[model samples]
Target: MKEFLTDPHQIERESMRIIQGHLQLDWTEQELKIVERCIHTSGDPSLEPVIRIHSQAIEAGLEALKRGALVITDVEMVRAGIAKKQLAQLGSTVECFLSDFQVAAQAAEWGITRSMAALRMNKERLKGAIVAIGNAPTALLEVLELAKDPQTRPALIVGIPVGFVGAKESKDLLWEEHQELPSITILGNRGGSPLAATCVNALIYLAVKREI
Candidate 1:
């Protein structure tokens, strides 16, 4: 699979092709316009063109899904009972689900940075300290699960955390849960958040770009 940073339009086009190839879905012109608007507003071409939703995020997600837009949403959105049933009814129409684990992971990474910053008593110095300590893998898994489609098999699973209660366990659970899938790529206990996020983002960028 090819991976590179590209413009939003390019990513959107490639994503459209990938979804069509994998799921046999087509985007209406209006749907494409919505995506373009989102991309334009976001102003980050590298940004994944996901229809994100919280509780209220579902309306937008549903609209996007109907229009052939790829969705990346949390479990709460489904649990809220807003559009979960309808979304599932789409039948292979929705492309991805970013579980709580994914959200927690991303949050944990930020928490770690924040914690380290507090410990150092300086936000500006945190990056250097984090770099000196190396990347944490446990943090990476959380974020990945958040961004990854639990339905689509993952190629790498990196678990990098220092010493947080339940952090390692969570990653372990993720690895165990998906162990049967050979597409998984897992990093050992030594992996760090920075590395994990970078790697995961790269993989996701490739996944969206290649339409995997």
Candidate 2:
């Protein structure tokens, strides 16, 4: 039998220390926190090179959280993984519209994915909100369309959907063409709900300067 750290806090501290030691980036403290969280969630030190953060993304997310921005996630799993207690403390709210009746109707009507339809149906709600897309590349693509109208743009986009299909391309487009948009993303198809949610929670903690 093998023994390991049993205390959650101790385990987290050890994990962070290990991640920090492995990270080779020159990212700022806040940016490093986001990357640390992603690597921690994925349990992959190799993620150090693939993780990308827009210069202003951390600040944008923090400011929005401080202002009680709405948080919109592409899937229920991402929404469920967010730190609700921290969000409540910040006076922010998190929501996933994928299961909403209107979103479903729009999806069927447009012959699009529910993820895409959810973004279209809630474009208005995206304004200045923090958006997290962890499961569907289509949703990330759809949000990029809505972002063309600057007034409807999200404050920060955590676009890290996991898949072998359009996921890598969607994130690539986000980084290359959407330089004006503040965002954090993985360069490859190596992201998921927990990774996306952890990025949001990292921002929440950074917003309050609370110790993780």
Candidate 3:
């Protein structure tokens, strides 16, 4: 039998120590925090190289959180994984419409995935909000389309949908074509809800730290 670390804080500290030992980049403090959390969630330090953050993403995300911006996610898993209490403390909120009946109906009517429909339906709410997409390339693509209109543009885009389909292409388009948007993303089909959630949680933690 293996001896397991039962204390959560101790386990996290140990994990961070190991991750820091593996990190090679000279990332900024804010970038480092988000990268560390994403790596910690995925248990993959090698992912550091492919993780891309726009120059303005951290500051944009932080400022939005500071202003009590709404954090919208593509799916409930991402929303559920976020730090709800901490976000509430910062006067921010997280939401997911993936499972909503209206979203389902809209998806059916539009011949699209629920993720895309959810984003489309909530376009107005996206204004100045943080949009985190962790499960669907279609949703990320839809966001790009919605962003063409200033009224629906989000403050920061966390686009890390995992799949072999359009995931890589969607992210590539976001990183390359939408350089003007404040964003964070993995360059390949190597992301998930946990990674997305941890990224937001890291930002929330940083926001709280700034207040202390």
Clashing residue pairs in all predictions, respectively, total: 24, 0, 0
- Candidate 2, residues 13-72, lDDT tens digits: the string is 999998899988798878888888888898898998989999999889989999999999
Model 2 stretches astray by more than 4 angstroms: none
lDDT of 2 at 156: 94
Total clashes for model 2: 0
- Look at candidate 1 and tell me the lDDT of residue 196: 28
- Candidate 1, 1-212: lDDT as tens digits: 99795887777666655443432224443333333332333343332322211222223323333443332211222123223344344431221222423444544666753222222222221111111111333333433443244433222222334345544554455455644322112223332333223322222232233232
How would you encode candidate 3's per-residue C-alpha lDDT over 29-118 as one tens digit per residue?
A: 889898888889898999999999999999999999999999999999999999999999999889998888898888999999999998
Considering every candidate listed, which one attains the maximal lDDT?
3
**What lDDT does the true structure give each of the candidates?**
0.32, 0.93, 0.93
Superior candidate under TM-score, 2 versus 3: 2
Q: Which candidate is the best by TM-score?
A: 2
> How much is 131 displaced in model 2, in angstroms?
0.5
